[model samples]
Target: MTASRSDALFENLLESAQRLSFDSRSPQLYELESGDDERHGMTPEWSPLYGTPLWNSLTEQERARLTRNEVAQFLGVGIWLEVGLQVALLRAGHSADPSRPDIKFLFNECADENMHSLMFVGAIEAIGAKFYQRDRALDFFGWIFRHFVWDEVAYGVVLAGEEIFDVMQRDWMTDEDVAAPIRRAAYIHVVEESRHMAFARRKIRDRLVGLSRIRRAVSTLIIAIGTHLIAKGMINRRVYEDLGLDWEVVRANIDGNEHHRMMFRRAAEPFIEFLSKEGLLNFGARWIYRKSNLL
Candidate 1:
């Protein structure tokens, strides 16, 4: 478009960024310590094994242990995702006009995400938890995503990660019973990510105009698979072992866990609705989401 239009878009984005920017340095951001109860890590209903026989078999203490480990694993995954997003966003910004609003907001996003990583790491360390690595088998997708931001597909990929977690964090922040530390972290993420999600949605929708149906179909499948894998990877099988739970039994429960399925579905609602509105959630993509139980 015109130089004036890009400058206008950038100005609006930068204004929002300056208005909502957060500081990770506040002493209040890190005041909670996990004592006997680790409920702060996660709510019981969020556990993968919640509502299963295995979950019923555990004492409250044991449940807290599991929650702690499970939450830590997710934060580890957050670190991984935020790291990738920061890299990809920075790289994608290279083609932007350095003086434009998009580039400035892109850099702002990177800064926000870096602070998020530090906050997540602080939470993990405070819980005395270990980080879980992503399943390397899917590294190729990461490579493709990192290298390919030319299409609107790239922002859609970014939104998938943000929206899924955004929903969950929204829930956490609202629940009065959630621990302050977790609540605070979720609160921070929810606030800042609201802006990021808005930016991503705007970018995707604006860029999707005039795209061919064939390309949209292909990107839809790629995004579906990416979302499925990202959701699956967050469970972190090794976390069960770390918590002294049998992976086999835990896996069995998670496979058919109605609560887990519901959680996935609920968390995905806004994302699915947005994509549906955009006409990206086509028949083939719907089938994939059904297979993943995220529809």
Candidate 2:
């Protein structure tokens, strides 16, 4: 991308951030309805166990409870990703010229991410759902990524997470069957993250302009691995145990879940297409994505 085009993108993103920002503490955002207990915490079809015999056997209340924990797991992972992104942005900003429009936008994005984390935390609390335990391996990978990854690789990984969540949140925000708090949070996230995704895409495209073939291949593999970890980390096996279900059975069901696999592909399709067009989906990356069930 040209410098002029990049500058314009940042300027427009910054303008939107100024005009459309929201306070996560707004009481209206957390308003609950009388029958909220009847609602799913996420779209039921997105559940890993959806269409399985176990899922069919559950009472509506039981299913709702499971979905509540499932969505909370997603929100919890989102918060973790947002925090890592913020750290990466701040580190990038350290040596960057503050006068640059992109740097300004970076700081603005950090502020937005902070609010998003707060919104996720509040939503998890509102639904009376517990957060999943941290995966130490993923946490270590996040640490390495935030501190070391840069340019196309960094932005590509960020875009993958944002895009996957964006697809799901678009569904959750509009689904009347979803919980009120989750819907409200999803709405806010979808609105703000549109700008973030645009910025990441532009950065990835620009950064890849003259990258060496070897570097591009390495970056592609790293991004694919990061995406795989993110896909796996979104749902904790503990969610099943906490809900009084057998983790092995749930894992088996998820592994065999054509519906769940289809949902993953649907959520990831846009990013996969974008990556392919950018020449980031080499043989190795494609294999990783397939294993993640996101191809």
Candidate 3:
């Protein structure tokens, strides 16, 4: 895409953001009606243990607790990813021309992400769950990306994370079976992230032009590794352990769960296709994606 086209795209995004922005302190976020505690924190079909014999053995209350923990893990990881994106956006703005439409859109996106993180925190708290700690190794890599990466690589990583969450949130937001706070937060995130994703895709497409083959390969590998870490880190083993289940057994069930794998692949499909068309799905990257069960 040409520079003018890119500018126009971001200008449009900025307008939408300005018009649809919401307050994080809205009272609707705190009001929970009767029986809200009994609702699932996410769609039941998206549960990692769904359809497993072990899952079948759990009582309704136990199942609800497990889903709550799982949702907390997702929200916690989302907070981590959002913080990283905010850092990357600030870093990009530091060296960018303030007059650029893309930079303005990114700053707006950073503000949106801050509110989204707050919403995730509130949702996790409302679910009566604690944040799950990410794997140390993934945290280290996130630190590197937050501090140094830029251009297409930065936007690619951001896009991958957002796209995965977007898919799940689209389901959660509209599912009446989900908790009210979770559903509301998901709705806000899905709406706002639509603009962010558009901006990221346009940036990635614009930045990838004329890139050297070797650099593209390296960038592809980095994005794949980041995505693999994200997928692996989304569900913490502590979630099962805290719920009084053996981590090993739960891990085994999840590994063999075709339903869970299919959900992941479905979540990744659009982004995977985009990467392929952008020439970012080289052999190494494709292998990583397959290992992550995202391909």
Which stretches of candidate 3 lie above 4 Å from their native place?
none
lDDT of 1 by residue, 20-131 (tens): 7667767677676455244546766777788899989988777877877887877777767787777777786777777667777788888888999888877666655667
lDDT of 3 by residue, 1-295 (tens): 3999888899999999989987777867856757878888899888989988889999988888899999999888888889998888787778778878988887899889989888888888887888777789889998899888967888898899999999999999999888888999999999999999999899899888899999999999999999999899987898899988999999998989999999999999999999999999999999999999999
Best by lDDT: 2
Residue 112 of model 2, lDDT score: 88
**TM-score, cand. 1:** 0.92
Q: Over all chains combined, what TM-score does candidate 2 have? A: 0.98
A best-first ranking of the candidates according to their TM-score comes to 2, 3, 1
RMSD of 3: 1.1
Q: What local distance difference test score does each model get?
A: 0.78, 0.91, 0.89
